[model samples]
Target: MSKTPAFNRRAFLGSAAALGATSVVMPSYAQQIDPYTGQPIVGATAGATPDAGAVQYDTHANQRHNISSFRAQDWRPYFDNLSNGAILCDLTSRAVHYWSEDETVYRLYPSSIPVSEDLTRTGRTEIIKKVEGPSWAPTPDMKKRNPEWPDFVGPGPDNPLGTHALWLSWQYYRIHGTHDTRKIGRKSSNGCIGLYNEHIKELFELSTVGTQVLLI
Candidate 1:
């Protein structure tokens, strides 16, 4: 940095002009906030609110930030696959986001749609295959604990597996139909992924026996 006279009026005017020009072309996708206070932020001169459709707090704790104030660009990251295209899971928010083969975004599902109450912190692999009249075999532990549940589970609208089950390849973790629709937007599951009954049914209708499923 070089020192200049504090009262350099010409220099100040030139710098202000450049800043004004830059702000005019700033993209909506960029997120900015006050460096000191965690409030909606823009440049020093004028405060700007975050763009709802663009910039979003990357994590529930706001540990990371993003910029998405302009255009129809997506701000979420995802995993790509040949059969499943790309998918994004916001674990903090419990939301599943899906995109097309071309990476054109499509749908967003609130987390409450499926919950895993018994979910442990350990991460593991799982398999998934669409099944009709899916039977939910309660673990011996679950049966011993939950005496209310029948010994042999059967498929129905109220079944825990609901109408469809995308059984996980990782043994027990499944993205399955939910009997409780009210819990869709919450972090309440028995360690298996859950989807709204209607949604799971739709996914079931769309998927074949060998349809590939991945958790991101």
Candidate 2:
């Protein structure tokens, strides 16, 4: 009979340690980078959408990520006064910064911006209307682009506008919640700014019509 090989305990333990280290490191790395793009995953929210052309994952992944810029900001640079309150939508950062009239409240939230520069509108605008359980109707241009899209979508899980909407002075423009939370921190909208459903609910309560808005 062949002599039994000596048990290589030291080698076995060394291999086991290395395997454990690999297990621990891989998931942390995976969480940081998007599987599809190999780019760092950035932002506070993520989810799916049913609306046509709503998920532009490839487009967003290819675009330069500005994760560092998504941060808190001062309200003074963009507004004369808090008034009802003030909202700053930073298109480049994909963030929404809010300030209460008395300076007691400040909120910074990740947001979704227009899909392209042509669809984007900068400068100042104001909240003209607020709606809860808001309904959605595709803009004529939206219908023209996707004739298969529904004529209307009532408030629910499928509504692209999510639970609330703060309509802006610019027609067809809104600071709203999106059922597609993944859109937050990405350029995925026709022209509106989108926040997570929960984030928008808090903003809706904290804000009022005439809240100053600036997109830059």
Candidate 3:
């Protein structure tokens, strides 16, 4: 007999394609940037909106979110920093944008939590590996153990890897999904990049197991 196709999280979050959002009333500290030069975009007054048309962002409000902090004069270090690799997000805008060299950049799916202080590491290296739906397996090194930890949910809605998972070049480092939808576009994860369920599904499907994940 035939078995069921693995459960896909993207299928469950179908609403993501039709999703909408409202803009956060950001603090004044978050705006200001050089347009021509990609530098430490200075902070701007709370009421001003700059770079109205150049910055590419995806927002829930369905209204334009100006990237007032970046100056057009600034220059991105250039993707040449690492060839055949993708920038997880565009720090030039200091916002979450993911795209390849030839593509237009857009806001990354929002993130759930801020960077946990626990994720302290001095340095990171680059490598390539295969990615698959994370099979929530408990490792011997886990500080704490969950006896009831789910194993191999077999690629369904409940899978934390969600719509997609990018197996990093290094071992155990992945860019995958989060059950936490509210938190995106911020620093959060256990040394891995997390994307919204829908967005990840798109990435996962577009990518393959050996796709290179660069974290320089």
Candidate 4:
């Protein structure tokens, strides 16, 4: 297993208290740009605290960070709807959860492509395909932004898709691995879900082509 971050509940609660309590919107999906990473992040929301068991820390940064301030409305409600596996991309928390015989959750920071608001899609979809060591092709829109961007990048360390990819039913979206570890817990993808290489490898091993993927 790759190095996983440590989770210390006592320390987290202490820091959270010091941070002060603030009221926020309900069913909060508010978005904002992160000052540190310059990537968009889901704004904090006002809701009941998540069960301690369901909470985990995203230890990519030196400071403490909670994976989710609110619980998934219905934990694993789509279990019966999946055959191969199921994945939840919690856009509100910048995290991912994989469901199989057993459940595994991961916190990620992904880069969001600067696109029109209409293009930011939200819904449930199926994993159309799965690939290992996948190549990347810049979209036409991406190329328009950077005329010099490479048309294709073969599987390698520099490949933006990293080592594994779970293609979604949505034509342009995917859940893939990332070579840049720093982007693991921020909003940084162009619609696709981004995970650390290790996390993706784990998911790839457990997931199959027909897996259900929820973008909530």
- TM-score, every prediction: 0.53, 0.74, 0.49, 0.62
Please write out the lDDT profile of model 3 over residues 63-151, one tens digit for every residue.
Answer: 32233532222114533332333433332222333443344432244332213335422233332443455544433322132233333
What lDDT score belongs to each candidate, Candidate 1 first? Answer: 0.43, 0.70, 0.38, 0.53
- Residue 28 CA displacement from its true place in model 1, Å: 42
Off by more than 4 A, model 4: 1-74, 77-80, 101-119
Off by over 4 Å in 2: 1-65
Q: Each candidate's root-mean-square deviation in Å?
A: 17.6, 13.2, 16.9, 12.5
Number of the top TM-score candidate: 2
Distance from true location, Cα of 213 in model 2, Å:
0.7
lDDT of 4 at 157: 66
Candidate 2, residues 1-216: lDDT per residue as tens digits?
Answer: 899655342443244212311111112343355433455655521232323224333343434435567656888878888899999998887778889999999887767787777778899999999999988887788878756567887887668888989999988888888654446667887788888677799999999988999999
**Comparing candidate 1 with candidate 3, which one achieves the higher TM-score?**
1
TM-score of 1: 0.53
Q: Which candidate is the best by lDDT?
A: 2
Please provide, for model 1 over 2-66, each residue's C-alpha lDDT reduced to its tens digit, 9 standing for 90 to 100. Answer: 99635332342244212311112222222243222445544331212111011111122232111
